[model samples]
Target: MRLPSKALIAILFATAALPAAAQDTAAVPQSATAAALECGDDFATWKQNLANEARTAGVGEKGLSALANATLDQKVLDRDRAQGVFSQTFTQFSERMISDYRLKHGAANLQKYGTYFAKGEQDYGVPGPVVAAFWALETDFGAVQGNFNSLNALVTLAHDCRRPDLFRPQIVPLMTLIDRNVLPADVKGAWAGEIGQTQILPSDYLARGVDGDGDGIVDLRNSPADVILTTARKIESRGWKRGEPWVQEIRVPAEMDWALTGRTNKLPLADWAKMGITNRDGSALQDNGLKAGVVLPMGRKGPAFLTYENYDVYLEWNQSATYTLTAAHLAARLAGQPAFDRGNPDAGLTGDAMKALQQKLHDKGYDVGGIDGILGTNTREAIRQEQMRLKLPVDGWPTDELLADL
Candidate 1:
């Protein structure tokens, strides 16, 4: 898919910082003669200059030519719009991912690749199912890998304004891949530009891609072993602890210290036990030497968890807490645990309702800024503020029940 022109324009505005007047002048439609003059006069020259920068950054002559010849397709832009929002609720996202599909597939995969999992666990310390969970989340047990051109997407994103600095370094390696024939010219992937079964970037693929199946080529597209092993390696790179569980559901006492329930406010396991934290099944917090922090993602009324360092490792795979929780929960289910007991309470808010909730929070002396529907830091802080004000145990997440009350 081609990148969106508006996105491209945004990128240009971000990178070049073109003056407002110049932008207005450039935006006006022109006839063919005027367009050719405008191209030579301004926009074409600017693009040519960026092309020169690309070539200097190690894009080979042919690679640079390919990029120059390419145009950002509106279809790609439409795809970006379509792919903007996640459809599942935090509960549904968790349920479907941790459902029978993952469990059955994970069990079969564990059995089929028992040796690999065992070896990987022994060698890398990351659990077999954790690796399998990543596989399920990333590619759905190898069912549907993405189909965007990695080169174009990365190039577009790198050159695009929003995060050009973040993605800029990727361009050279991406071009290098094209030049070295590591990635084919026709490679397709996700809209954000990730590629192959596990959705890795070119640089990551270059650094850690391995021929896990003994077939010689490290192709994640068709090889389950390569995807699994490479994902395990990525986790290892992020400091996955050997023989440690990522997180476990816990039972917190009604009057427990809510202050100790977040990554930002961590206390030792012993300290948590002293405050009356126990496993959901009523087991005592025995001498598992690993330190952990409590997290009540859905506030005090929902399930509480004691998240270990390995949970952070899972977070490195996907930054979202919800995404990480889903992966970890799915991993647990695959290893034979029941689904989470507390249902999600924030599933009912429509987009507009979410914004209204934010506004209500701001009105109630909470600091949720202008009611953007995005549940970002401001919204979260507002949730915490309300929880503190109401004297409920504060977890920063907003729940539908809480919104309704507001």
Candidate 2:
């Protein structure tokens, strides 16, 4: 998730900033060379380059001053590197994150912000539960928004060589917020430079934010109305379809073609029903034209989900499969669905074992999307392919036997 500090050895060497006439108007430039702010550049010179970028983006003197005042924090780099995998299975993660407190508050919030929820849905087509699920999971309904200095975090990430492509663009919007007095110059938020109750990034905040309370200010941190509406807008902007299912619990047959599973391998519900894939209650699945994938988060003998298009929105919010499932399940729970059946899945491989398995897979003509030790969608796809090749169970779980076979 982060580059090694040793790769930035040249950061101690300062260089002159690029002339403003040469820079483009993009919030973040496409090339480091275009801005003359290489990963190897010194920190002080990098800040000056960032100020130049902000200035070209139409930021005034005040915002330019905020950009200039921003400092690179090594602690931010440490956190970015430490941003790692969710090592829990679906059941364990859901059980932990969907606490009694969140359930109670999430339900109450549905009523507390009922007006805004309805308005948000009417306007943005995202339901209250979907938005509220994110609200509950991120920062606990605004109770625990991160305390890291937002300015420092943004500057630190933009200056860092690893993901400057992502963080660099966020600087202008953040400075814009400061310039407009919507946020202070020294705002505090998440380690990745996200702000507000839902921990939204500055770009999303700028693009999707709205003044929901009608007070003429988009105050996401303190106003429930603003938080609810703004979150709905963001989810809707991420391709959330109106009046569609996100995820539903399902019971798969004891024996079936596991190759038909995974998010990308979508099949009509009628076809899945022919394979005896039923609702969680053992009832026949509705033969609707809706297409869904049978998602086995912990392999075959584990919690199964019929993931629909709306589930992609959850993935967009956070890419971790465990976290995505937990968020979707929490949304369902908030909307009055019963608890999911926990199946006795086989134990998964340890982090080291998973990384080793990934390396082996990568070596043998598979793209596991880097050996991060996390079972992302691409990693799962590679595991399924390898399992099929080896005539294994093909459940997409990295088992010890699979490792030994490799």
Candidate 3:
């Protein structure tokens, strides 16, 4: 999740100030050659190159000045590289993100800003708890919006060769924000350059900003009303259906085919019911003429969920499975749902343990992919295959016992 610091800085300096005319010229060095240059070798050059890109992207003088003032922020780089969320299991991630403090504060914010949420729900047909869930998960109900300089962070990322393709295009919208004065030059936010109480990216803000506070300004950073309403608008624009459950924890029979359990593989409720799927409490699953996919983030040993169309809308906000699940589960909590029935808080294996397990599986001829210490689909599938080979319960969870046996 974090960029390689020395490599990123070297690339930023080496690519400095190459003119737009040089972009197509063979004389211009590639990102690889540029990344090998000395640190701060030609920072002015990089900034000027970025300025040219901004100009081409239609940014004006105010935007140019904002970019000019940006400094290479090592702290932003550190934060960008320290994203540990990917290493966390669903239980671990949920426990931390939907902490007791967050839940209590989120509920309070929902009440304190009841009228604003009510209006947002009414207008967008998005539920109040759903909006509140995003608010809470994003920045802990506005308690901890990160303090990194937005322009500097965005510029640094744009300059870095590690993910220039992804971060470079974001510079233009950020410049536009400065040009329009939607955000000040020194605005602070998450290291990836998301701003506001909801941690909206500059591009999303530009595309979906809404005035909810009746102050005639869509101030997402300061106005909870705007933040909530704009978030509602964003999810709606991203295809959030009115009156739909995002996801609900459910149980499937042991004999059910494991191949069908993923976000992309949808089946009708009737089919699932026929296979002995039930609600969390052993109740019958209602067939509502809707299709849902079974999602087992923690594999068979963990909880299962029937994810609906609105769940995909959550993906548009953040692509992480746990992130989307956290917000949706938080929404369920805010709406008085009970705790999930199947997750074990102690089931998470450490990163090193995961790597060891991956190595052991790899040695056994299982395609575990790269041993990055993150339990992606390939890793989980390998674990499942190993368990089946050993005649053990094929739950797909990497445990200390499993590692020891391997």
Best by lDDT: 2
Candidate RMSDs in Å, in order, are 9.3, 7.1, 7.6
Question: Superposing every Cα of model 3 onto the true structure, what RMSD results?
Answer: 7.6
Tens digits of per-residue lDDT for model 3, 11-125: 2111211111122122212343443342234779988876776787678999999888888888767765555556778876676566677677778988999998998888898
Q: Give residue 260's error in model 2 in angstroms.
A: 0.8
TM-scores of the models, in the order given:
0.78, 0.90, 0.82
lDDT of 3 at 35: 31
Native-vs-model 1 lDDT? Answer: 0.62
Instruction: Write model 2 residue lDDT over 135-163, tens digit each, in one string.
Output: 87776788777677888887787777775
Query: lDDT of each prediction vs. the true structure?
Result: 0.62, 0.78, 0.72
Model 1 TM-score, all chains together:
0.78
Look at candidate 1 and give me any clashing residue pairs: 11-161, 125-242, 147-189, 148-188, 148-189
- Show where candidate 2 strays beyond 4 Å: 1-37
